[model samples]
Target: MNTQEYMSRFKRFYWITLTALLVAASIRPGFADEALSRRDRQTGFLVVAEDRGFIGNEEIIDEFQLFAKTRNASLIFVTDERTGKYLRNSLDRLLKKGAERIVVIPLFISAAAPRYELVHQLLEREKLDVPVSYTRPYGESYFAVEDLADKFRTIPQPADTNLIVVGYGAVDSDSERKMQADWKRIAEKAAAGFGFASINILIGHDKKKKDDDAVARTEKLTRELADAVNGDGDGGRKTVVIPFHLGPKLDSMMSFDARLQQLLPPGTKFLADGGSEVRADANSATINLATWLQREANQSQPLAREDVGVVILSHGSDFNWNETMREAVQPLMKQYKIEFVFSMADQPTIERALRKLEQRGAKAAVIVRVFAMESSFRKPVERMIGLDIEGVAQDTADVHAGYGHSHGHGAAPSVPAPRIRTSLPIQTVGGLGASPLFAAALLERARTLSKNPARDTVILIAHGSGSDHQNELWTQALEDMAEQMRKSGGKEFHAIRVATWREDWPDKRAPWVDKIRAMVEDAKTEGGKAIVIPARTTGQGPEDKFLSGLEYDLGSGFAPHPMFVQWVDEQVRVGLARFADIRRTGMTTVEAKSHSPYPEKWLWW
Candidate 1:
C-alpha cells in the first residue's frame, strides 16, 4: 500500500473514465446540421420565357433567382419558344439536382398565349414524378395592371397628345383578336387615369399572308390615327406611341413603328418610347411575382380571376363562421374580384356589394347563394329591387295533414325592405334545390366516408322548414338527390333515407332527431355503416348538435367544393343569358316565365 500501488490504481481509474467519456461522445446526436439541411431544402423554379434575348428577360430571370435564393430555393431559366431541347435539358438538370418541388412560371404576356400551352404540353409529355405547380402568366395577373399604372404615372402628358398603345399580335387570327381586345381594355384603363386627347390600341401582328400587305395595313392605321390627332387642332398636338411589351423589342415591331412614324403627315410631331414595358422588370413587379409564386406554392392552387367580381353570399352567424366561409372562398379570390357577403349577418350586405361591383366597373356580377334549399331570404332580395317573383308558398290549411307551421326561424324577418336599385339587370337564381350537381356532390361525400357502401346506409339531412309546403319540397328534393346517389353509386349502398330537422305538425324537432337516431341504430344492428350527409350549404350548423352521439360518419355540407363553385358559375351564366334574351326579344314577364326553369308559381317579376 505504498507509492507503487497508489500510482497503479490511479492509472486504472483514469483510463476507465476516459473510455466512458469517449463512448458518450460517440453516441451523442448532432442536431445543428440536421436543422440547417431542413431549412435549406432544394426548391427548383423553371422559368419559361418566350425568347432568350428579349428585353428584360435576363433581368426577370436574375430578379426571380435572387428572390428564390432569399427563400432558400434555386431557380432554373429556360426559353420556351426558342427551342424544345433547351427546356428539356433545364428540366432534366433540375430533377437531377434533387429538387423537392418544381414550380413552372410562364413569363408571358397572357396565359391565353400559345406559348403557355406549349410549356404545359411539354411538362405533360415529360411526365416527371417530382411535384410540380404552375402559376398564371404575368399578363393575366392584376399585378401587371398595377405595374402599368405605376409606369404611366412617370410619363409627362401634354394635354393635347394622343396615347397609342401597341401590342405584339399573334399569328393565329383568334389569338390576335383577343390580344387586340385586351390591349384596347388596357389602353382604356390607362387613359382613364391620364388626360389624353384619345387613345388607340394597334395590333402589330397581322393575319395577311404577305408581309408587305401587313405593313401597308399598319401604315394606313397609323396614318389614320395621326390624322385624327392632327385634325383635333391646327398645331401643338403630339402623338405618343407606347410599345406595350415585356422585353427585347422584336425587329419586326421596331420596323413597323418606324413605318408608322414615317406615315405621319408633314409638321406632325411624334414620339415613340418603351412606355410601360419598363415596368415588366421593375423591382415592384418582381416582388409581386415572387409573392404570388410563394402564395400559390403554399396553397397548392392558382388564384382566381382578377377581372370579374364575385359575391359569395351566405347566412353568416359568428365570427368563426364568417372566417370559415372566407377561408373557403379565398382560392376564388386569386382569379376573381371576390367579396364575401352575409345575408343575415352584419357588414358587407348584398346591397353594399352590388354598389361596390358597380364602382369597380365589373363586367359582370355573380351573386352566389351558399344556401342548400330555397330560403325566406330570396323574396326579400327580390323585393329590395322592386321585382315581383312568385315563389313556393306554404299551404297552412293542410298543416294538420302532417306539414309543420308556415313560418318559423327560417322565415325572412320583417325588416324595412332595402330600396337599393341598380341599372345592371339582376338574375336571382334558386338555391341548391334538387339539381343534379348537388346530387353529384352528395355522392362524392358519401364515397369519401364509405368503407364499404354495399354494407352502408346513407342518410341525407337538411335544415327543414316548419312550413308544410316547404317541408314537402325539401322532402321531394332530398328524395331526388338520394335516388341520384343510388343510381350513381350502383348498388354500393344498401339503402338511402331522407330526413329533415323539423318534424310534422304536432311534433317538432325531437321526433326528427329520434327518427334519424333510429335509422342509424337500425343500420348498425343490420351490420351496416350509417353515413349522414349534411344537405346544407356549409358543413357547419345544427346537424351535428342535433344528431350528437349517433354512431355515424357525417359528410360535409355543399359549400367549398369545386363543383359547388361550378354550379354557382352556371347559375350566373343562365341568369345573365336570360336577362339578355329578355332585353333582346322584348319578352314579357309571362314569356320569360314560360322559358324559366323555376315553376311559374315561383316566378315573381
Candidate 2:
C-alpha cells in the first residue's frame, strides 16, 4: 500500500485498538475512583537519581515524565535506589500543599515493577495508604504489535520453505510455559497456511546440566526435523524456520542455529536470508520495532525525512555476538532515509553520534534505547547523550580550559585532546522495555505463553552485576522493563518479578553462589513462580551455567544463576538498536573534559 493509504489504515486501526483496549479495561474493576479522587491536592516533585559506584537507572525520570504528562499526575519524591534517598527536599512544601500521596516511583523498570507493589508493601508495614503503584508497562495502544506481526508476514517465501521459531526461553514457572505455547501456536498456524510440510521449534537452553546441553539439544532437534522431511520430492513437503525473536544473530540462539545447521544432512534445505535474528548491535531489530510502533501509533506517516533522526542507545559489549548484531542491522540503515542513525559503545558513544548530526546540519534527533528498561546503562547515557548541545559544549570548554590548555595549540600541539562536536537538538525516546512498540512484539510472545498456562510463575533472571556500576545499569533496565508484564497483561500483582544476579549479593559479598541462595529464599516464599531470562549481552559462554543456576539454586542453593538468561536477550536488542544509530553517523567525537587535580581528601583506591 502507498504511504497515504498506510496512514489512513493505521489511523483507523489505532482508534479501533484503543477502543478495544478501553472496552477490555472496563471489566477490570478500574482503580478505586474514590481513592483516586482523594488525590486532589497539587504538589511539585523533587527528583534525584543517586550516582552510585556505577551509573544507576535514572533515565526513567525522563520516561516517567512523559508517562506522567500523559496521565497529568504530579511527582513528589524521586530517590536513588542505591541510597534510597531523594535529591530535592520538597517534602514540607508538598505537605503544605496538602499533597496526600508521597509517591516514590523508581525509574528503573524491573528493580521495582508496579510502584504500588513496593508502595503497598511499605504501606502495609508502616500502616499507610498513600497508594504508589510502580508505573506499569506503557500499554500497547501506542506500541506496535500488530504492525510488527505484519512485518513478520512480509518475510519472503521461498519454494523450499521450512520454519524454525527460536527465542530466549523462560526459566521460571509462568514464562517457560508461555514461550513454548506461543511457539507451538505460531508454528502450527504459520505452517498450516504457508504450506510448509515440516516445522521445528527450539527453546535456547542454558541450565547447569551437562557441558553440551545447548549444542546437543539443538543438533538433536534439527536432525529430527531433517529426518521428518521426505526427500522423495513428489511436491509433497517443504520446511522453514523463523526466529520468534526480533534478532536472529544473538550468540545464544545463533550458537544453537549454527550447531543445528552443521548437523543438517546435505539434502536438507534451510531458509537463511528470510528469517529474523536477534543479535546484539543489530539495527534492523530496533528499526523493525520502531517501524512497527509507528504503524500502531498512526505516526507511520512518512514524516519529512529531515524531521526524524533515529538514535539507538544500548549496553554494548566486546563479544562475537556484537559483530553478528552489526551484520543484522546494516540492511535497515540503508533502507530508511533516517535523518541520522548511531549506536553507543561501538566506536561512537552517543556524544559522537550527536556530533555527526550536528555536522549534518539537522534540526532534531530522535534517541531510542533498544534496551527494555531505565537502568544504569541508560541513566548515565541520558546525561552523556541527551543534554542540550549547548550544555555539552560548555561542559567541554570548561574541562579543556580548566585543565590549563587555554594556551593556543592551533599549531603543532604539544598534547592531543579529545574532540567534541556541538550542534544537534536531541529528543530522548523511551527504551523498549514494555514500551508500546515492544509490547506489540511481546504480545506474540505472551500469546504463546498463555497457551501453556500450566507453567507456574514467570521469573526473568538477568546477568545482574555486582562487579561494576555498568553491569548494574543493564540489569536495572531489564528489571524495569519486566514491570510492563504486570501493568498491561493478564497476570496479577503476584505473578511476575524481574530478578538479577548482582542484586542478589551487594558489593563486598560473595559472587554467584550467594546471589543464588538469596533468590532461592525469594522463590520459596513466592510460591515457586520464577522464570529466568539470562541477562548477558548475547547467549554464549559459561554465563548460561550461571543463569540456569537460579532454578537449581531454588531448592538447593548450591547452583548459581545462568549467565545467559532472557535479560541478555533484552540487552542484545538494546545493543542492536544502538549499533544502527552509530552506523548512520560516519564518525563520532567527544571533547575531553578537564578535571581539577585530586583534592587532598580524595584517597586512591
Candidate 3:
C-alpha cells in the first residue's frame, strides 16, 4: 500500500467507527428512557407572589419548593412587583423544559387582586399553546378561613379584648374597595372563632397615592386605631393589633406598626408580629397546594387497602364535569380512601369500582349517590350492588308505588336479584332528597339571582325521572321545598312554581319549555323579573340549553357548595350508623318481593 492509499483507508475506518458509536448511543436503554420521560412529563406549576422583600419572598419560595418536591412537579416562582416581561421570561423557561400543562397559583390575599389580571394579560400576549389553569388567590378557600381562625386562636387575650388587623391597601380605588370587603370578611371569620369584643381592619397606605401619602395615612390609621380601642362604651376592653401582611418584617410594615403602637391607647396591646400574611406553621398556602397535588396524584393510584372505602357515585358525562366532581370531594379524601364511579358515560362503572375496593381489602363500602333525588337511576345502582328489597307489600295492587301511579294494570315485572355479591358489607344511601341542606342550597341559588324577591317570580327546575311515578315524587319534593321556602320568607316572591325536565312520558320535557317561556313572559308583563333555579347536583346542565335566549335569570345547581358537602357528610354518617345497626342485629340481608331495594323508605328518599 502506498502512503496516500494508507491515509485514505485510515479516514474511512474513522468515519465508520463514529457512525457505529452514534447508533449505539441512540439505542441505549437509559438514554432512550430519559428522552421518553422528558417527553411524557407534561404537568408543571408556576407560583406567583408579590415580592415586597427577601423575608416574605423567601418564605413563599420555600413553601412552593416543598410543594413541587412532593408533587414531583417542576416549579417556577415570580414576583408581581417585577415587570410582566420578567414573568413571561420565567414562564418561557418552564415551557422550554417540556411542561405542556401548567397551573399558575397566585399567592395574593384575594382572588380579585389586580396582579392576577396582569398575569393573565401577559399569557395572552405570549399566546402560549400549552393549556394553563389559574387557581384563585389564597384567601378564597375554606381552608384559608379555617387557617385564619386558627391564627386568631393563637393570640392570647381576655374575653373582652378587641382585635384590629392592619394591611397594605391597594393603590387603585377599585382594588382598595375590594380589599376592604375581603379583609372585613376574613376578620369576621377570625373573630367568630374567638370571643372578640370587636374586630376591624385599618389600611396602612392611601389608595389614591400609595407611596406619596404613606406617612400621612399611617398617622391617620394610628389615630383611627386609638379611637377603635377606646370608643366602645365598654371602657375596660383591651385592643390587640396584628399586622395583616404577607411579610410583616418589611420596612414599611415595621414602621407602620411602630407608629400605630406609639399612638395606641394605654390599654391597647400589640401581638408579636413576625410571620407572613399566612402563618408559616399553620396551614400555609404552599402546604395546602402540596396536599391538593398529593390528592390529585392519588387519583391514578390503585385503591388503598384500608378500613373503609367510599365510592363517590355520580351521573358523569363530560371529563370536565368528572374533574369538578373530583375537586368537590377533595376535602373528604384525607379521612377515607375514595374511588369515583360514574353511572353513565365514563370508565370504571359501579361494578368495577366495587371490585377494586374489595380487592384493596376494604372491610366495608359506602355508596354515596351524588344526586338530587332517588329516581330511575337508583334502581340500576341497587341491582348492581346486590341490595335486596325487604318488607314491602308483594301484591301488584297493594305495593307502595311512588306518587303518581295509574294503577289497575297487570302484575308488575319482576326485578332480578343483584348480579354480584361481595363479602364486604355494603350500605347504599339515598341522594340529597328533601334534606335541609339541599333546601338551603336551593334558596341560596335563588337569592343570588333575585334582584327583588317581592317582584321576581322564582321557578324551581329539576331533571325528573323517566317513570311517571318517579316524576311525581320529584315534583312533590320540589313542592315541599317551595313550601318550606315560602314559610321562610320565599313567599316575598310574586310566585313560586315547580317544573321538571321530564314532566310526563317521552314528550314530558317538551311542555316545560313552553311553560318556562310563558312564565318569563307573564312575569315581564306584570312588571316583575323571573329567576330559574337548577335543582340538581351541578350547575352545568340542561338548564342553560333549554332556557337559551330567554330573558330570565338562571341560578346554579347544588354541587361545590359547602352545603352540598355538608349533605354528603351527613349521608356518610347515616350510612355508617345503619351499617352498625345491621351488624349488631345480625341482619345480613333483607327480602321483599318489590323490585326496589332497601326496606326502609327513608333509605330510598
| Stretch of 10 with least lDDT, candidate 3 | 390-399
Query: Over the stretch 173-231, how does candidate 3's per-residue lDDT look in tens digits?
Result: 57667777777766675455356777877655422312345445545666777777666
- Arranged by lDDT with the best first, the candidates are 3, 1, 2
lDDT of 2 by residue, 1-605 (tens): 54344334433443443333322211111123233222334322222121111001112223334333312133222211211211122334344545554433221111212221332333233332343212111111112122223323544453345555554323343544545554554445333334444455555432221233434444545555555454334364444444343212222332334434554556554433233432232222133332222121112111334434455544444654555444434444542223222333222455566666545534345555544344323333433332321112222111111111222324542221222222233435444443443432332343344324233344455544444554455445555555655556626324544445543344523465455555544655765534333433233223344544454212111011121123223433443444344322311111110131112111100
Q: RMSD in Å for candidate 1, one decimal?
A: 24.8
lDDT of 1 by residue, 76-98 (tens): 33333334555566666555555
Q: Candidate 2: TM-score?
A: 0.30
lDDT score for candidate 2 against the true structure: 0.35
Clash count per candidate: 19, 76, 1
Model 3: per-residue Cα lDDT at residue 227:
78
* Candidate 3 steric clashes: 1
Better of 2 and 3 by TM-score: 3
- Every model's TM-score: 0.42, 0.30, 0.43
- Candidates 2 and 3 compared: the better one by lDDT is 3
**Alpha-carbon error at 102 in model 2, in Å?**
49
